[model samples]
Target: MFILSGLFCIPTDWHVLIITFMNAKVESWCARPEQLSDMPVSTWKQLSGQVNQTCQIKNIDWDAVTNETDISGEFGMKDCTKWEYDDSQFQSTIIGDFDLVCGRDVLIDFAQTIYFVGMIFGVLTFGILADILGRKSVLIILLLFACLTGTITSQMPNFTMFAISRVVNAFFIIGIFETHFTYCIELVGGKWSTIIGMGMEYFWVIGWLILALLGYLIRSWRSLTLLISLPSLSAVFMIWLLPESPRWLIAKGKLDQAEKILREAAIMNGKPLPDEWKLKPVKDFENTKKTTIFDLFRTRNMRGKILILYYNFFVTAFLYYGLIFNIGDLGGDVFVNFAASGFLEFPAYGAAIFVLMKCGRRIPYGTSLILSGLFLLSVSFVPRGVYYKDWPCMVLALIGKTCVTFAFGALFVYAAELVPTEIRTSAIGSASFLGRIGGTIAPWVGKLSIYHPYLPVTIFGVNALIAGLVSFLLPETQGQELPYTIEESEKLELASLIAPSILKPAKSTQPMEQEMIEFNNIPEKVEENEEDNLSCYSGDSALSQKVCS
Candidate 1:
């Protein structure tokens, strides 16, 4: 409980704080005309004289200019004349407008994206470690490292140091996230999977609220970071409240320990286990064979499927993070912008609850992405001065934001549903890795837009369009029970979906075609071969012979 709550408050702040601080700096730089390029020395002398003349008019001594190098202990002015009476050099920083900095934000944006890239690698590597050692073991290692390294990042003396620390911290925290997702979901039953999965997202909102309150109080970016680290101090105690997942224990062949944990859960829920609830050694462990990373591409459909996943995930991350990081540049007070954004998300969340509960997953998931792309493109050309209303641009930006937000929520659930249990996390994590690169590219995309105003939005719109079309490449998982293995997943016309999408079978769906999509209408069933091949996790392929300890 504490670890989740504590670590939970960290990243949401990371995302919003940088944009807020940088935006302010960018505007301050632009307000002074000194940084403007191409102003001749004669123009400079004129502006300087004009300023000095103002001092004369006011009959007050103009404040004596201080040397910037004297204050910062760097950058000697070898060509002293360069600083002389030059109005263009008068601005204190690089780039004038916050929007221009938004245009130039390649450096900081890459840092942010690379941080998430580290997370994808972390999931893959630590997932293996979690299986080899215990989940609790890996969690402890990652959390301690995360708390230590993550706080140190705030105190980094330079951008390079900060970037390196951020990646290190990203690696650790993501390991914790991957472990926690599987652990918490297992402790409850499979029936509660959606609740456990979706419920955790509320922590993200909690982090945002804390950030808003902290932003109100601290304001300074570094101090806000210090506040984020405060939560980590309480994590050690909070994690002790819940027991390890009973299912994880059973997978390790620890029937006694699994039973103990299950009994404790029953006691907590105030219910008794039925006779069939008793733990027994699973015979499904028979014939468990070794699987490798290469196995993912060995089969014809599998190779093509991986390619499509790579495509889907890459585009998903690119569009999602790009839009999020650049939200302020659409033009507004960032605090108000961030707040309105948070408020707008309520409708998205409400829609998720409604759709997942009543209508099921397929349409809402696909529609969210399709509409997201369309709305974004609609905003792309929203002229600064419309035919009638000048406010049309801002209105379009807000609408684009809402559409993307809803799709962001949809993608998380949608990805979890696509693959059979055999390789779900690996597929998702591998895709996320590519996506993180897209995320890394996002800030640069935003920066590119500073030079080319419509660049980032158009790029984002294109990706959303592709991802929306590719949604059909994935089979609709609505009524089917979560397939526990490749055999089960294949038994459904998995080939049918894959065939349409391949570079061969991936199902690259056009919007109209998605509505016409249908299942093979086979018996609502799990194949016998699939049930017999239960060597992997209930939802992802985390094991070959047995669930790792």
Candidate 2:
């Protein structure tokens, strides 16, 4: 399973890079001024290539116009970064000076807008079906549609048709990316869940990295999309080899099939099945209860669920997407910027791995988001010459990129952990659906700030701020067990809410080494996550065991 997800890295980065690549060119073109009417014939000759090219807008003074406004926020900086796009209205969506870029941007603009629409709607529809059907069935459906639609979308005949296809492809395909955490949780025992499930998304950066490289080579979003599109078919075939979710099977009373999947896992792990692994008669999860929308809203604890989802949806999409689309605005080598930006992501995944085990969720998740926001704000204030200079801007941009990557990695587990298993997938699916709203709006955010680089910083900063505060509203899921149901998972501090505080929570400043030694001793991946959680449970026992007699 990890291997398949690792493979997904190629296309995932490809998706971001290609999209970013497209967005960069249109933005850079818009930032420049109109060229002189009586320019040299040699310059006119330069106009020859620009005239008909789908991307280039002919006869523009790209240089003078950039002075009128700073697109990268740091008015004077230029550097390496990642984040990228084209379609006419779509072009306008991200950059308002649409006229300057020629009409080619209209098609690019529409394509991205339509694609996001497809993404938003596709997640909801697929999630409902996922809850009704087993996870495995929906897996096949999403993969098939993803494979066929993604491949077909690549061959779109015209701009209008292609834009519509982006929506369709996004709708059918995005459900899988959104559902991965839930599906992984169901597949593994509690112990191995966080690293394996969330770790898969780190490799997603690898997909963006690939596209960054490809942007240097292929230079077209269409070709880049086409290149990765081939993998969906293979993904369908590869996933067919995977086992179904046993928990889902048991929920539907398909105990026999559930056991079969479990046996496969046991064999894969080379471990003997527990005695309780034997298949038995089962009953449906919905046997005695009503499952409805109100169920998600009725509980006080569920409100936390809503808060986390909305925060994640908006923050992840807004900061991550907005910045990527705006990367080219910094006025540097597009390929270098994209690659350097992507390279920042490698450390983020490693940081997440350490933080998830040692630091717990709240600090890592909350602080990273706040830091990302702070950096964006910092970029706005950095003196143009000192901060906006090539290396300086690159350094800041990379720092900003790293923070978002960390937040995203943490959210995979944090979001999934917020809800109970029954509605967990649906919750994640819904939040992610709305999260793509940030993605939908990001291009517009970029476009609106065409002349002002600091505009996106303000916009993304607010998003980061909202996400960080809302994160505080959520329970600390780090030391907590994965909730079996929404009820079991959250012990709403109602009593403490109203009652006088008994004791203030103590801060731990114990050296990091003690924790590292305990962490390093774990023999298996499952043992690490499980031990961290179980060790929390065995607080007294663990302390006693370590005590000197």
Candidate 3:
């Protein structure tokens, strides 16, 4: 069952990297800029190659445009509208097939931006729906439509059709991925939360590496599109193997359904339930006031957590996606650059796992953000006089990428742990919605590079710096039980920023060590009532035991 949900992360993560590669394809049909110069006739043939063979000849007075823009010594600048593209570079793409070059370049960004716009809708629609509808059912429905719209997007005749279909595809696919994340976390006991969450992120790293390989092998945009979308076919079969989240069912008052799933799980694990054993909703969790989105902001503690976490989500998406979209422009073999960037994430996630367990979530999560921001800012200062300027710049970028990847992997579990169980999906959904706003803005950052190369990284660095500083204010959740209700969440103590953790208790921090000792000294008791029994079977207790072990 642990492996089953891990398998689900592959396709969802692939969708994120796939669209990044898709931008490479769709934007492939850029206008082949022409150099209008007064070079000798014989020099023209020498300078022109396969890329510029199809260039349109335009007669313009060289003196008239001399001060208007910088004209190259080899090729003077000419209007893109009058230029023709080299077909050898791009055989087919939405940009190529529809001749969407020059003035229409924004469409490429539009196509990419709209997907995140759709993701905003997906997060909103599915976040609440996952809570209302069973996570498994809503996920399946989303998967079905994701496959359909993805296929339709591949076959679109024009940019409008492709953009529209992609928007719809993104809406459902992003929803499925986010909902499945919530489902996977809920499916596990809390003890395995970091492992399960980070393990799934490792799959996302694998998906990016796979996309790089596929993008290399499949040159045509449409072919690559279809190849990536093909996995959605397996989503149907995967659906049959998945189970409704018992936690969600319990939350929604579906005890019979929840019990059936739990019993089957127990049977599969060879730990048969007692003959008298019966599962029911926890009494304290029942008849809780109906939660609304406003509930997140209604309380003082929650409002701060919600706002800070929301910004963290935004910063995470901003830095992560911004770095991804800029990879192609980094001056290397696009394929190698993409693959190398993806490769660094493997160790990043591994490091994240280590730090999250040993150092606790708040310090590691915040430190990673700070380090990534510092690295990103430092890239602009790489000495131009160096023999290999590009290498230093790329290394700095990769380091920043690695740090953000580590932060993002841990951020999901951190966010999940901070929010209460009942409204967990909605909280995640809202955070994701804010994250997509940053995602939507990422493509525009690439555009900012034209004004100044460092401008985009500067914006990313600033956001990351703010987010990292704010992370210190968040309560740490490592070695703590997940709260099941708003009241329980409210009772959770805010770990002092300067206080030493149990894992690294300072000499002055006797209170933290004493608290840990007291918590451990508490003896476990057998279930004597329905509520006690429910807590044992609810997965949280099992998770805590796993953590202790």
Where model 3 places Cα greater than 4 Å from the true spot, the runs are 25-56, 59-90, 284-287, 327-332, 493-549
lDDT of 3 at 316: 97
Cα displacement (Å) at residue 211, model 1: 0.6
TM-score of each: 0.71, 0.73, 0.82
Residue 129 accuracy (lDDT) in model 3:
87
Cα RMSD (angstroms) for every candidate in the order listed: 10.1, 11.1, 7.4
What ranking of all candidate models by TM-score puts the best one first? 3, 2, 1
Clashing pairs in 3: 35-75, 35-76, 36-76, 191-543
Candidate 3 C-alpha RMSD relative to the actual structure: 7.4
**Candidates sorted on lDDT, descending:** 3, 2, 1
- Per residue, candidate 3 scores C-alpha lDDT tens digits across 263-358 of 676666556555555654543444467766678777788888888889999999989988887744655577887787777888988888777767
Best by TM-score: 3
- Report lDDT per candidate: 0.52, 0.58, 0.69
Error of 3 at 472 (Å): 1.0
